[model samples]
Target: MSSEATIRRGVRNSRYAAIPNHVFEDSRLSMEARWLLSYLLSKPDNWTVVIGDIIKKGNCGRDKARGMIAELVKFGYAEREQQRADGKFGSSVLVIFDEPRDSHAAEIVGETSGVAFLPQTDLPATVSPSPVPPSPVKSAHSNNLDSANTDCQKEREGARAGSEESDTSVVEDRKRIERDFKAWYRTWPTSLNDSEQAARDAWAALTPEERAACIERTPTFISAVKAIKGKFTFSSVYLKGKAWEKLDDPKSEVALPTVHNPFSRAWMAGMLAILLRPPLTANMPAPTKFQLGQIAQGGDEADAVRIDRLQKYGWPRVNTMHQRAFDRQGVTVPPPLVAISEGFEQVHRDADLAKRWKRAFERRGWPWLPNTGHEWFFFPAGEPDEALAKFSEATARERGDDDAA
Candidate 1:
């Protein structure tokens, strides 16, 4: 398992040591802070300890140890002491865990007993090559005086450090709030459409200050309202105005001017025209002027592919070829001819050709014939000769020619 995962698992399994009174002054103990407290209380005071030494002993990264120590100090679980430059014993505040049997608890007991019993592991070795006489016993009062001085100095240093950190955190919080404000401002929209009620509802949930910032940064809400109204007009009307009416509120509605403006009308109409244009499908190719002319002249047998290609390549002359053929053959071309001609027109505008073909089919005694929009033009059910004769006369009239009797 990864080292982080191992540490997390260890933390979960271990019981939390009771928080010290000093630590409770600051609210909340993070997991790392609690871990540091436990690790500190588990050991005797002496081990030549430092932040780096703790990292190596704990099997944690140096940066992680540093962060943990900072958090411990922030929550008052640990305190730092200042060492004197002379290498003599410096001021140090012993961190007292709330546990009854804590290392610091032993130290407190020792102070009252008038005998400081240093942990065996922390004591320096007494070394001598030859027998040496023992020194006279020092006064217990003097020892207590030294320890108290060191503890007081450590407490003062810790308090000063805590104050500095608190100031820095306050600044960081203010900056974070400012960043959130800017982000909210940039995303707020001035207008909403009929289908955007959910989005508006979400926006309304923001605080008044946030909403004001959004309105200031976005375009005027009136303009947005007008644009939405214009774009949704057809769809709203199709539903008998129910869609637009749903957005109205008797209490909160914003009043708009009633004056008609030509510029606004023109702009709205232009937008509508663009919106209503047929979308080009993946399979459809753009038509050329030549292809359009071929569709106009060729009765039915026109080559739609050839006309499509000629139009795509911007060659209008190719359409004149089909028109010339139509002129020479006259209007009464066979059904095969009419089919091809209709197909050419269908490539550019299927809806227009479908309507024309449906009308022609109905004019004949083929009202029951099924039509597939614009895919094919149906021939009436009858003898081939009779159908052909009727088609020829119709074609001649359609082409403004008199060849068909």
Candidate 2:
């Protein structure tokens, strides 16, 4: 058994900010991006946090923070705008989660922030904070002291520092809200996908928990709807109704799986059912162009191996077939056994039927490719006939091994 390990950490006031669990659980973000997101959420309202401050406080280099910020903005988790150093109207504001529509500034006064940020492991506590508000009662008491001017001077200096910290916090917060807005804009699924403005309003109306829940369930809901519709797009669900709100409890559980039956396919007489692709009824197109990516493991090297397998085994068998008879007449009918196998497959979707037919055909040294969606042409194989015969023998032996077990 491993020993329990204790870790030491530094205390910071930013820990006061609450971070929701959903942000961390999001599969769309990287660890660094998520941590930066939490840090921005921890700042006081209306503060401007500069990149330099993030670099310094985040304990990360300039390039890393920049890249993380770029990634966040790209995915709609953060936003940024240029600001002029000369005091102007363009100064950034960390306007909580959403842009206020009807709520007056006076109304929101003293209201706690809807978003709270707490630091994660490998992240620094980010709440440098706004300058502390002056205590009116203390100022009144200090007025009686003879050294009031000195006290006032010290307070002024402290306020300036606080103002700077507050500005940094605000800047970071604005970036965070911008990300939230962008994320909503890009990801909100609807039935009739119009009215960006209405979407924004609906998004703002949702509580943080509701928004998080919607994001979590978006994929599952989209998939379930698509399986039922036969032709579903994000727009199919998104372009018509406010399906996002209904995502809190998904009604259907069905999901269309990968539309292929690659296993239980075999060779018969010298014929093999090398490909057993199923029809795609979902919004995605039937595969028009065949590539290794279609049947690949999706890594660069693995894809290369799949391509090699195709080139080595697949293309050669296709190339050497005798097409002379079909070219001369346009129809070279399969021998009697091949015709019967083709007829049987026309009405059945059974894998066992395909495999048994394939094995029986292979025993006679012919492999069978089905005619579910493509034209089947007959041709003579010189060398592959023997190759396919051996292939069938190996398959038969393997099946025997299974049966014996």
| lDDT of candidate model 2 versus the reference | 0.38
RMSD in angstroms, candidate 2? 24.1
lDDT per residue (tens digit) for residues 281-323 in model 2: 2433333245544555466655554444443344233222222
Model 2, residue 208: C-alpha shift (Å)? 40
Q: Residues 189-238, candidate 1: write the lDDT tens digits.
A: 42233333333333323333444544453343334344334332322131
| Candidate 2 TM-score, true structure as reference | 0.21
Each candidate structure's TM-score, on Cα atoms with residue i matched to residue i, is 0.19, 0.21
Off by over 4 Å in 2: 1-16, 82-405
Clashes of 1: 8
